[model samples]
Every structure is written in structure tokens, then in C-alpha cells.
Target: MAYCRCLTPAANQMLVLVSRQSPPYCSIRTMFVSTRRPHKALLKTLHASRRRPSVIRWQSQSAPKKRLLNITPQSLLVAALITGMVAAVYIWLEWKKFVHQAGGRIAALSDSGIGTLNWTLTDQNGKRREYAEFRGQWLILYFGFTHCPDICPEELEKLVEVVEGIDGNPSTPDIQPIFITLDPGRDTVEYMHKYCKDFSPKLIGFTGTTEEIDTVAKSFKTYYSLGEKDEDGDYIVDHTILMYLINPDGKIVDVYDKSAKADGIIRGSIKHISEHEKLRRKTFLPF
Candidate 1:
């Protein structure tokens, strides 16, 4: 039998304390372990197990870090695109609103600014007739050339009838019939003088230089162009067939086209004139 030695845990602890206090040669080594009862090995294993629990706690505390509110490049790109689209839509809506408001303002300005009624031109008698002179009278203004073979003559005849009708009706404003020639190159004062007499004694004719006529036409928004000239330097003139009705206050209150009839002009002129008179008397002042 092999020899072995062992002690109880309390005895072994007492012996270890005494061995530490004594010299190295006095330590009893054979009593520390036994094959049948290995208490020292068991104690070492228990201490290692305790250290393992501390490592386990460290692992639990340092578990995979959770991602809270994490942002990636792809997510960032998507958010930026969404924000840009929303901003573009908002800006576009505001731009449309601004354009709509501007369009309305421009239309209102156009209506008030175009076809104004302030101009001066020389009449057939070589006399200057300032537009202000006819401010108090109702103006029946026509723009055409004496060379107009059919439309001008017929329109002027109709104008004569209108004048005669106005003369008979005292309710209407005293209408001054005017014929302004668009063809300054062909029509002279003598030519228009003859043309007016053929229509009515009450009708007055007006002619001016080419530049003056162009200025008046532009102000009135009358369209006219010289047609192809013949070998003899004569050409037909293309123009807008329109007649204007000027109020006593020198404002263009109405216009008539070729399709307009006598009754319409008569009724419209009378109505507008009566309305003006009513307004004037209502706001009348004595100076």
C-alpha cells in the first residue's frame, strides 16, 4: 500500500497558518492533498467558479448595444428627398397664387389704359380741332378713307341717318359727326371736303399728316396698313372698320362695328347720356 496523509479542513487551515509563520523548511506538504479527499483542489475550483460569475455579469452588462434612433445614409437620403419634394410643392403653389394675382392686376390695368381718347388732329378746313373743344359735345367718330368704295359710303350714309335722328330727338346729346381719313397720302383736305358734302352738311371731315394719323390711330387702337401699291403708286388701305362714341367728358363710352344697327347705337347713346346727366346733376355744384 502506498502511504498517503490528509487532514480536516479546520486542521489543514491551522497547519497552513503555522507553516506561514514558520520557515519554508517547516511547511508540511504531504497533509495538503489526498487522493480520496481532495479538499484543497475543491476549494481552488470553487474560487475559479466565483470569478466566472463576475465575468458572466460583465458579459450581461456589455451585451450587444441596442441601436436607438439610428440613422443610415440611405435613410438620410430618403428624408432629404421627402423634405425637398414638400418644399417644391409649397413653393409652386405660392408661385401660382402670385401669378394669378398678377394676371388679374395686369388685366385691370390693360382695360383702363388702352384705347385712350386724348389726341389732336387737323380737320378738313385746315383748322386745328383740339379734342378738348368737343369735350362737352357727344362725338360720333369714324376712321376710314374716302377711297373705301362700299363700306365707307354705306357707313357714312348710316351716320347721316343717325345724325338726322339725333336732331329730331331733343333727349339725345348734340352729336358731332366726324370722319377721320386713314389715308393721308391719298386724301387731302379738298378730297375730304368733297366727301363730307356728299354725305351731309352737318358732317365734319378731318385729315392730318401720316405721322399724326399714325399717332391718333395708335392711341385709338385702330389697325391700318397700306396695301400693295400699283404702278401709279396708288394702293388700297386695309383698316379696322370701327366707330367710337365719345362722351361729353371726353371718355370713350362705346364702340360700334359694321354689324351694329341704327336702333342699337341710338338707344345705347341715349341711355349712356341720360345716365351721365343724372350723375352730373346729382353731384352738381354752383361756383
Candidate 2:
């Protein structure tokens, strides 16, 4: 066995060193020293750790992210339904405007005859009558002669239907259907009397002198001319196929063409007269 020993220097004494040699036997010696130094690899690792968090924060801020939720089939269906509803509403509004404009145009183009008139004439019964007698009622004044072959009869039939239609309705205003003879010379008072009886009982025929008929026709702006004589030495009268709608005050408010059916005549006349009466009542004050 081998042994080792330690020695300490005394105060104010010189330092001394000593060594010992041992025999050729197994022995071991050891010495220990400590020094202060910085760890470079540890500092580099700490810096990398701090920079990694900053890099991750920047990437998260710069990247694009979806804000809304994912779209579904239900959402798509809702979108399509809304679009269809909007389109339907737009189409309906356009169609309504188009119809309104078309009706206005038609009303504007239809016949509108001359205004009011005052006259005196002879009835089919040879009784004298004044135009003022027909006041406070609607009047359908037609100018034609019994000598007319086609137009007169056709017009007379239409007038008969119109008269029946108005008389059939309880709500419509009372109206007088008048047939003034354009051929006063040929359509004698007796002939007109018989002719009126053939048509509706409500029809009234008027006849008078040539000058009187001419005056009345001019007042209404009616067009009538003698046509060529037929094979039997009989002449026909060509006249306008106008049906005049006269108001209660003997004023020609409107005129309808021959194309107007009985139903249309009744409906349009009633509508216009009712509306006009309502307006007049609202605005007029009894004196």
C-alpha cells in the first residue's frame, strides 16, 4: 500500500516543495483546477429561441385568413329564391305600365264628336219637340235615312242592342235613342213612324224640313251625301257610321265607332258617365 500526505505553509515562512518516490508498484496521482468562462453555444441557442417566436408572430399576421363560414347548399338555394322573386316583381310592374299606356292610347284614338247643340224638330208622330227635352238624360243621336240599304240597317241593329243593354241595366242612367232622318223628303213622317215601330220600342224617330235637317246635321258635324241612283231610280245616302254619346246637358261627350259592341258601349258609357257625374257633383254647387 502507498500513502500520501498534505502540508501547509506557516506565516512569514518561505514556501517549500517536496516529492516522494515509491517502489515500482501500481500508483496514481491526481490534480484539480477551476476557471470561469462563457458558454457560446448556450447563448446562441437562447437567441435562436427568442427570434423563433417573433418570426412565427409575423407570419400569422401577414397570412390571409377566411372570415366567413363555409357556404352550403341551403345558402345557395336561398340566394336563388331571392333572385327569382326580384325578377318576378320587376316583370309584373313593367307589364302593368304597358297595359295602362295601351288603354290610354286606345281611348285617345276613338271617336269624339262635336260639342253641345240646341235645335227644334218634328217627331215621328208629327209632334214638335225641342232638343232641350232630352236634357238630364244620356242621348244616342244617329243621323241616317231609311233609304240606306246596308249601313243604316246595320247601325240601326247595333243601336237597338245598345238600347236594350242600357234598359236592361238598373244601375245605368236613363238614355234616349234617337234616329234623325237624313232623307227627310223620302223618309216621310209616316214612314219613320212605321220604321221606328219595327225596331226597339224605346227608339224615337225625328223628321223635319230639309233646311231643319241640314242645320241639325251641320251642328253635329255629320257627313252625309247622296249616292248614285240605284237600278230602280232610287238614290242611297252615304253617311258616317258614328254613334254619338251625349251627356245629360245635351253635350256630345264622346263618340264610338261602329265596331263597338253593345256590351262595350254599355260598359264604357256607364263608366264614363258615372265618373263624370261623381266629379261634377263634387265640384258643382247648386245656385
Candidate 3:
């Protein structure tokens, strides 16, 4: 139900005239209107004022790209942690290599205590520990009594500096610092523990029966002479002041005296350890 409003007054008059004429002219008018208009113009227009608007769509848009990996904050943190661990392991391996280098000069003062440094002494916890327990690590052997008012403490503190110096270094093997009492009668396990803790936790205090201590001292060529007890029952003891650096296989590598500085001890110990490692490798393999 649509009405055709002609473009001109003449066309409108002609349409009216055709309407007044017979059906043949009406058929011709229909054909003329049908051939010359858009579909919207030809649609039913009972409510012509309420015409709908035309719509258009485009077809060139695309989706966003896909990533190979979507890295989040958590993923970044994990990667950093893994990288740190790898670096730590690499540093550790390099340190081991440094400790295994073949050429370092240490003037081992005495070879008398070289092959004979085995003992089973009581540890700070009063536990019986064998000399073989310190096999795998380099030994910083010291023999002194806890009761010494001056020399023993002074020497032990100095020894601590040396052992800790090596310990703080990354390019070195572990050095196990040992304190064996020359005056075992007074230096009980509890006493030894208390005294050694005053110096360093890394210092392992050891004591045993008088006979056992005597045997151990004799093996390392260390001497101790006890003085007479006073009215209060307190006594004094004189002992050797030496720091022996022994290798993993219980062979003495270097000897340090009171004159030996911390740096000297560390340098000599590292060099000696490296040398012993080289020797061990040579022993097992012909090449």
C-alpha cells in the first residue's frame, strides 16, 4: 500500500490522467515506477514519517596477535630465583677448582707429624669422636689448655682469624678448625665447649683422658707440662703453640707458629691443600 508522488507537476497530472483512462495506461504507469526507484522508496510507506535509518558494516578488522609466552610477575620472579641458584652453584664449583689448583708453595716446617695425626677424642658435646671424622676436610690442628690465662686464648683468637679468613673466601675448600686440650684434667667437655664458644662456633673443642691426651700430643709432637695447684686448687699448664695444617688424608701439609700471620696461614693452607689434591689425583691415575 504505497503511493507514488511524481517528481514534477506535469508527471503528477499525467498520472492522474492515466488513472482516469482505461487499465492499459495504468499498467504502463506501474512499469515506469517499478524500473526507476530504490527498494526503500518502493516499500510500504503507510507511516512515511517513521522511516528506519540505513545501516552499514565493514569487513576489514582482525583479532589481536597470539604470543608464544605470556610472562607474568610470578613467572619473572621464578626465573630470577632459578638464575640466582645457577649462579650460586657455578660460584661453588669455581671455588672447588681454585682449591684443587696444582701449584702452590708451602714450606712445611716439620714432617715429623705428617703421617701420624689420628686420635679418638671427646668432642664438645662429650661425644667420642675419631680422628677419621675430620678426613674429608682440611684440618687446622691446635693443641692447648683452656686454663691458660694469656697464650692459649691469644693464639686461639689469632687462629680463629685465619680459619675464618679462609672460611669467608669463596675460592677455597672447607678448613675444619680443631682445638685439642693439652690439659685434659681441667678441660672437660663442658669446659672446652664454653671456652671454644668464646672464640668461634666454628672451633670444635676436643678433650679426653690424660693418657689419651698424652698419646695424641706425642703423636703431633706437642708438649704440655702442668704446674702445681695453688691454695684455691687452680693450676697452670705450659703447652706447645703451633697450628698444623693437615690434608684430607691426615698428612701434615704446613706448620704455623706464633709468628705466622693469618694471611700467611690462609695462603699456605690453601696452597698445601691444592698440592695434596694434586698428589691424590696423581696417586690414583698414571696420567
Score each candidate by Cα lDDT.
0.73, 0.72, 0.73
What would the per-residue lDDT of candidate 1 be over residues 1-287, giving only the tens digit for each residue? 11233457655522231122223233333335444465775456445645542221122355797889779999999999999999888867765664455345434535775446566777777798777888788888898999887988989888877777776787765789999899998899889888899998889998889998998888878899999988988778888888887767677767789898877878877766665564455421221
Clashing pairs in 3: none
Residue pairs in steric clash, candidate 1?
Answer: none
Q: Could you tell me every candidate's TM-score relative to the true structure? A: 0.58, 0.59, 0.59
Candidate 1 positional error at 109, Å: 10
The lowest-lDDT stretch of 10 consecutive residues in candidate 1 is 13-22
Q: Which pairs of residues have clashing backbones in candidate 2?
A: none
Candidate 2 residues lying further than 4 Å off, grouped into runs, are 1-115, 283-287
lDDT score at residue 175, model 3, on the 0-100 scale? 87
TM-score of candidate 1 versus the correct structure, residues matched by position: 0.58
lDDT of 3: 0.73
Cα-lDDT of candidate 1: 0.73
